[model samples]
Target: MSSESSQLHIFFLPMLAHGHMLPMLDMANLVASRGVMATIVTTPLNVPLVSRTTSTPTSTKINILTIKFPAAEVGLPEECEILDSDNSKDTMPLFIKAVGMLQEQLEQLLSAYNPDCLVADTFFTWATDSAAKFNIPRLVFHSTGFFCLCASTCVGLYEPHRKVSSDSEPFVIPSLPGEIKLTRMLLPDLPKTDAEAAYIAKIVKTVNETEERSYGVVVKSFYELEKDYADYYRKVFGRKAWHIGPLSLCNRNSIEEKLQRGKASSIAENYCLEWLDSKKPASVVYVCFGSLTKFSDSQLREIAWGLEVSGQQFIWVVKKHENNAGEKEEWLPDGFEKRIEGRGLIIRGWAPQVLILDHEAVGGFVTHCGWNSTLEGVSAGVSLVTWPVAYEQIYTEKLVTDVLQIGVSVGVKKCDGLLGGSIKREAIEKAVNMIMVAGEAEEMRSRAKTFAKMAKEAVKEGGSSYSDLSALIQELSVRRLHH
Candidate 1:
């Protein structure tokens, strides 16, 4: 075949949120590096963020395409292009509505370009029909682990939680590999308010419809990371899927790339690196919930005291709301920063998480168990203190604390909403100690290192993820010829 005809062209559509967008872009670049023609489609405002994170001098350049977001039409502010989970409780429906409005623009692009494959975020349920119209294969991109994917799928199918009498009552997920159990309160469907309930219903319908129609799923995971679930997702469910990840591994080559990842760092990378440099290897804990989570004032103070009481050096990235960036937080314990001055650093907005986690001085992570953070901590080989707060995060906590055994839980018992349910200083402190200072800490660290090494190996030439990606490209290439 001619080189022109043989080159596989793939379009990646990520949700407007950073957690979803960043990793899909990472996968786009990884595919582009393997000689596929990769294009990332998003709205105008998000182009700069995407370009900055993926601005690599690679052999194959990834094309960034834009479509207008109907912010004004959806009653969102003119500047509202991306979804911020912290402030999005009331605006989320509007945001999703605005995103769905891009269907016409996406259809236009699909008709004009007719890319060989569409690797779209799972949030874009409509993309399945769009791709079907063009007879192009659409792969659902999930920025989550196979464990959560399988669990969520099984829960949705079996409605195991329906059997439980109370929200706190536990039930086993049926037809799975092992005895995995969770309380009804921890399930994703437990919506607090009518608005949230409606939102959850919409999301569930969107996911179910899209998954049934799409060609297959393209998950951001590596086979070795969650082998049983990966196998279970395909063998038990009888669907096509590919696991080409620890997608974070693509950023391992450059420090500049790591720093510029996602949004600009709130603090200077050099400043944070210098602080970590002074600390001994595996001596510090890096605490960050993913970008979307918001903590109540009470919870923030509890975290502060917990970190102080744990007596471990830490760098915490506190999520700052867009409107209140300059406001003084009344939540921090009085003189908390002063007391932990040398031993702790609190970044009020975006922190260079990848850069910090990759540091030798960093050992344990205090994570909310967002898949991206979970995978990053794994890639960095850092043990974790899991405190899951939102959708599927609690399920991922099970993967980390139970399956992987590289994490300690802070005993979060429910899928709390965006403003997470508070855990006392004692629970946080105890969990931190279990992962960073207790006798079992060494064992967790050892396991983290083992997975970290596997993560790196999975992305290398001939590794599990590398081979999966190659197979995907090959399959798409062959299919393109017929089309």
Candidate 2:
């Protein structure tokens, strides 16, 4: 390829969560691997997190632009610091709004570097307007799965009907061109009040309008996984949609290297991986929820008991701060840790999740079904025990348990109005036991292994994800030349 042909420049703007940033970074790395110059625009607070994950050297071709958030004092204390506590939720709205204010800085950076196109996160809808103002072609990158995006769209479309009433029935969302059948139960949390609903409506409208004006949509999913929905997006929206994912493919080789140089304390403890090494093939379950989701004390205790009852070798990541700090060891049931000491490992903070999942001993995952976690689990060929906590997670749980049939759902509530409540020790024990020791466990293991193989194949040359990525680059390259 000539210098002109190979010289592709793209900017990546990601939301400020670990789940969102990690995949975006992986995509940016993929672009760079293809000889494209990629610039990742992130908040000052997230720069360290990205740096820790990528460990991009000064000599590396890719550029990382860490822009300061405006009205720094308005909220979001992390705006000033490099490593803020991961549990911060109050800053979400403010951080989202701040993306709009970074337009001037982004434009200045763009003019200096002169890139070919902008590839931004879905949350950065404002980037579309910025790109248009500067005559730069833009692409919206949905970091999550296609199903989750569709569920969010459903919430937007059905906003008017969401009312809290005693006799209210579940609202059925009309079929979107490329979307799967979804109910209100599977959707993300929508704005409840009329005022909040109007705000969300405005945001969704802006997303649709901006998407129409952009070059295309790039999703972190593959054609085989959601072919029907992918087709629906292209047909109904009249906008090009490409699936180029399981982005973690590129990280397989460098995960260890990245961890060695990563600044996060949690990354240093290789105990989880070491524990997995001791278990038999497909005998251990790995349980972790993404950074933001929280459970009540009762729920946490129930899960502990469940694991105890299941009598399975498991690795669980529990946040120290989320639990009662004072009663840390005392919180568990009598001799719980002792009974399962050698069999189970309880990681207090963030574990080296990808490394743990890829370990040979890990056969199943007890996950909150966050998109990134789901993709990681799938890529690792680990079956899931779905326990969705919030937001689009419910949709993710449905995808894993219902649509994909790759995993089983736990704590699922039926129409009995009994509120299935939290997973008790016995229920957890039973679920884990079935997945680990029963015939169903083997079936799920086989299915998970197959999916993992498919994920591997998808990233190889000529595979669906590989082809989609090639097509995305070609489309962007063509748009660059024509414009």
Candidate 3:
């Protein structure tokens, strides 16, 4: 490639959530490491968070450009920050509209910079038209797993069959290319009310249209992890799709360096690491729901009691919210935290998730099955106690327990027709005891370790994911030069 072609300037726009922002940031870093110029486009409020994240990084190749949201009157937050709102009903519509308004600003930014191409989240389908107007090649970045993507597509294609009156009956999803079977219980709740359903339908249509126009889709996953689905997308979409993931593994060395520096703020990490250091290898269970998922007080109490009864060392990261107020002891079972005072640690806010999972003492994870958490757990060789909350997490739980067999689902009563059934304290305690004390625990640990090794190898030079990333860079660079 010519020098100019080799040094491409790429712009990335990710969704507002932490899960989306972090992966896109990682991808930008990887591209920058290859001598490409990476520019991140985010809302003004989110600018501070994004800026802070990039500040510690020594690399100066990546740049962040903040854009103002045009329609502030439409209930969107004035600042470019993520709203702490839990009500999806109040947020999703406004977020979709805001993305539309942001397109005008994005168009102007593109005209000024004239970057080679634009890489954006799947949600920002409006960028397709804007990219075309600016004569820039666009690549849609799917933050979720390929399996969930397949499931969502199935919901879109088979719209008629998916519209069940209640969340009770299980419906089989068609056109799944993998050996896995997807039932309605595992699918995401596609906006049940008419207004919500309409909004979802529009989003689905936009995704399909955007995919048709883009150069390709870039997924943060590897071929070995979703071979059949990857192949299926290639055949059906007739567009180039590449798997370059566990992006965490790509920058493991840098992350380790960050940890070694001990520069991470206590506010951001919430001191979960100090607690893990006190536990034995393969002894502590790490529990964390991802950024979006939240729980009711009843559910929270059950989990606390379950942990207490399990009689194992555990570390739980609970985000402080409006609902969870009373004293910590009041929420937990009697003498729970006191009984395991030396063994249990409860963090009230953002925990150093990646670092905590990487710890040798963390034998098992109690997760909501978010893809990022799933990848981190598997990469760390930690077994899972799946407790999916919402969205595509149920599907992810299936992927972990049924497809991979690296983890077990806790309190999921499939035969009872309960979709992601609620777990009582006893159920939680029993599951943990089985996973930690039974002879099966050691076997699960060995399997988790093996999976973690595979994740590491996939990102190493000459590995499947590493080579796929190289090919993607080469292809995009070529497209940039020609366009």
Candidate 4:
């Protein structure tokens, strides 16, 4: 950012989900670090979450602003604002509609604050139109990488997915940048209900309408990671798009400190970090399936047995069930924890993921390939056993395993259908061993480390991502000057 110009007061609007919110907030802080005044627009529940990160006693230039979450009006339960709420699966249509209902309030805020730029979540597609009306640039902040988004958008346009005969059969979409193959089973279906279908239709309509008008589509990926897809995305987007990401790289120190202090970690930090400390260097496999993944009891048993059978030191973050009265490992195999007591620790809630990934002992990640975790895993330089469970993550799994060669797939086609339908312990054992201790492990680890270096360099001065952000700031500064 050029100091000769006035400060860039940018307004950031993130999706209410933690995955979406966390990255956009991180982008906000990144810009704020570069002398931009960031105003993050979020709801009440997310406010506390944001404060926990932003309140880390520094002269952060970010400000938090709130709008009422339409819980009562939308027939949602009280205190439910995030998109990943327990009832979100049921109430998703209402939730999307309710978020759209905030458009007027958002427009009003835009009119009042008059930000130079509006960096908005993909869910809030209406923000682009609002930015157009306000004569400000609305950068579409995609929380994922270029490869997955490009592939999905191309698939949506061509509907090549329909050409595939069966879910199990492999098919190729020519529009994707690399030699990527996908099975129909790997892709997820949209809303099943007619009412939900209508709501999703509106979201699609609005997003398509606004994407043509958005200033740029922002991906949280670096150029070297996805050069071909980055070029393809620019050609498809037909705008001055940027790839200033692996956003986790922007706050290396703060995240390291948080993981070190175990302050905001989901488990008992003292126990968790101490356990990691006890492990050999680059030895433990940290397993988490992000926030949205839910495993069935059968699946849990397979996973527990798989980890035990793999004979590797591991830390697994298990999702807590709504009702847990007696046994601590009720959702897991009956004697699961006791059997792997010394080798693995299962934290049945949110773990300080960023901390765990950054730990020196963490050599392998059993991830669902959620975009945030992917970027974080890359930044941390850990080989990944890609276990995609939902969404367009299958494409991301391809991005890592096939394209980047930094990950190996665990053959988790879908989290649904027969309750994960028994993820054979052998498949899990093979993938874990591949990344953790097999012959291919060195190649994967080398690539992971290489990508990690790229991620670190991308955020530093004079790097590709650094130049892109500078270009964005300069482009916006000119816009502000003209205004």
Top lDDT hit = 1
lDDT of 1 by residue, 1-483 (tens): 236456788998999998998899899888888878889998889999989877865425789888999999979998898877555667887998888888899999999998999988887888999999999999999878889988988888798987989988889888876788888888754767999978877778878778877889888888888999999989988778988988888987878878767988889888999999999999999999988888888899999999999999999989865546676778888889899999999997888888899999999999999999999999999999998888889889889987899998898877677777779999999998888889999999999999999999999999999998889888887887787
Model 2: per-residue Cα lDDT over 127-162, one tens digit each: 777787767778898867777776566556555334
Candidate 1 deviant stretches above 4 angstroms: 1-6, 191-206, 322-328
CA displacement after TM-score superposition, residue 4 of candidate 3 (Å) = 7.1
TM-score of each: 0.96, 0.88, 0.89, 0.93
lDDT of 3 by residue, 235-313 (tens): 8757678888887664456554334221233444434566667678989998888666556566778888888778888
lDDT-superior candidate, 3 or 4: 4
Each prediction's RMSD over C-alphas, in Å, is: 2.1, 4.0, 3.7, 2.7
Residue 214 accuracy (lDDT) in model 3: 86
Q: Give the Cα lDDT of each candidate.
A: 0.87, 0.71, 0.73, 0.80
Give stretches of model 4 more than 4 Å off: 1-5, 190-202, 254-263, 322-328, 414-422
Models ranked on lDDT? 1, 4, 3, 2
Q: What's the lDDT for residue 39 in model 3?
A: 95
**How far is 144's C-alpha from truth in model 1 (Å)?**
1.0
